[model samples]
Target: MAIDDAISFKKLEVFLAFMKLNNMARVSELLGVSTVSVHRSLHSLEEAMRCPLFKREGRSLIPLQAAYTFAEFAQRAVEECEHGILKVRETAGFNAKRLKIGSLYSLTLRCIPQLMIGLKLRKPVLDIDLTLGSNRDLLQQLADGKLDAIVIGVHTKSEFHDALDPELLSIPLFDDDIFLAAPLNSPYSGQTQINLTDLHQEKFVTLADGFVTSQDFWYCFEKAGFSPNISMRVQDIFSLINLVSGGIGYSLLPGRVAKFSSQIELIPLESNYGAQQRITLLLPKIRERDPNLLALTAECRMYGRHDGKKDGFL
Candidate 1:
């Protein structure tokens, strides 16, 4: 009612259509409103704009120049709004049809398989489409809406960082230690926990740059005060452990990976090892309410993990 108040877009829309049709009765029918209501909106819009939109012309409504000018701009604005609504609906439909999930390549080798098997038996209806990448790339994909969730390793103090934003949720599911992986017959094999001094002269097979697990490995060395001599650098966890099996070099890695092969042995660090490696389930912080993501997060927590040295590899 006040001149300073914002003009209602709905009123402007009704006015624009009335100006085009020049017949209140026809506009009312087309717009699914009573003629009286259409006339009220147009009159209100004209008053709001502080200008006359239509002039009385012998038995017919004649649009003023201002009304014609406003119609062109209003049509484009309404069209854009309608397009946005359509795009949002299409995006929603795609999300409902597929669960775009990502996992760290390291986890994709083992932990994710267990998750998939566990998830399918519980949710056959979930049309899972998995992407394998680094945790950084996976998180970026989640923020961009290309992925609904990610499963990745959580290093110490790494879980609560920017990776898990307020708009995203995460829960620790399992942990693996940065075990001192060595050949089954190595001199350090019989030792339950390998001391920092034991590795001082050993060769190391480590992950390449940009891997999260790599952070735990190198930082542990830094904590121990000496970087192990590098013998080989690989991008995948499975390969690094395999090279260890071949006696190529010794390396530090999560214990769960060692389960996939029997040729290698894991020596727990004299310091806490499992305390360094943790696995977490992550998903975007969306408000639209997704029952599927919530259920998947629950499944991750339910799958149990083996405690360190449980298989006599102490």
Candidate 2:
């Protein structure tokens, strides 16, 4: 016979409790419901099944052979449903103990570490796996579900670049200005502002093409109507900084990296060629409500509010 709409998983649960305890008051106490509610659920279950599964006797329920048989199936159904829920959650990375995060290598100097510490405080048991790469690589990994979240830089004026995926959600952390990175002893180091066109003859070091800084480098130079004399291209920001600091060449970098090394000087670019990098946190919209991601988002927002005032990175 087909089951009635009143035969729900909740009713099955109440039925199982009643079968186990054999007393209405006990089942009510265990399920945190009124005894009257428990009795109503059991009555509904019997009506839906079109079979009497219990023998009622003065505020007590006595199980018959049919009740015991039905209880076995009910328990299995509940267990299987619970297992399915667990598998679904695991597939979605929901409530997982580990959080896999991706980020730009440049942010490791300041932004990433501070966020990590705050995230740990908020979720003490959560294990964080960090992957550092260029902005393009990180964004791709996040889109593919290889990483849970990412911290990267994007153009401030056009926050959503053409390459950015619309399916992802972004949180603005802070706005950082791009500067001309030069060796401490360079002649232009004494200048407060340097025009990009004037540096056309100067050899420069830069991060590889996939990095946001590399895009910024090309954009500023293109606006200046001259391509830079690039002497070296590196994959990571730290290496590019080392090359610029060692008098190898000049490069364009964000102001947040200013505290990384005193050997390099950051000079503002001419207003017409100036660019700003907005450091942002991105996550998949599908997993935005996950507990771990929620905590991480909160930490990022807190950091964005205080990091500017505390570190003067903005």
Q: Pick the TM-score winner.
A: 2
- Cα lDDT of model 2 by residue, 31-132, tens digit: 999999998999989988888887877766778899899999999999999999988988878879899999887788778999999999999999999999
Q: Model 2 segments beyond 4 Å from truth?
A: 1-11, 14-65, 159-163, 309-314
The lDDT values for all models are 0.73, 0.86
Candidate 1, superposed: residue stretches over 4 Å from native: 1-95, 108-110, 121-123, 158-163, 272-275, 304-314
lDDT of 2: 0.86
What is the Cα-based TM-score of model 1? 0.66
**TM-score, per-candidate, Cα-based:** 0.66, 0.82
For model 2, how many clashes?
0
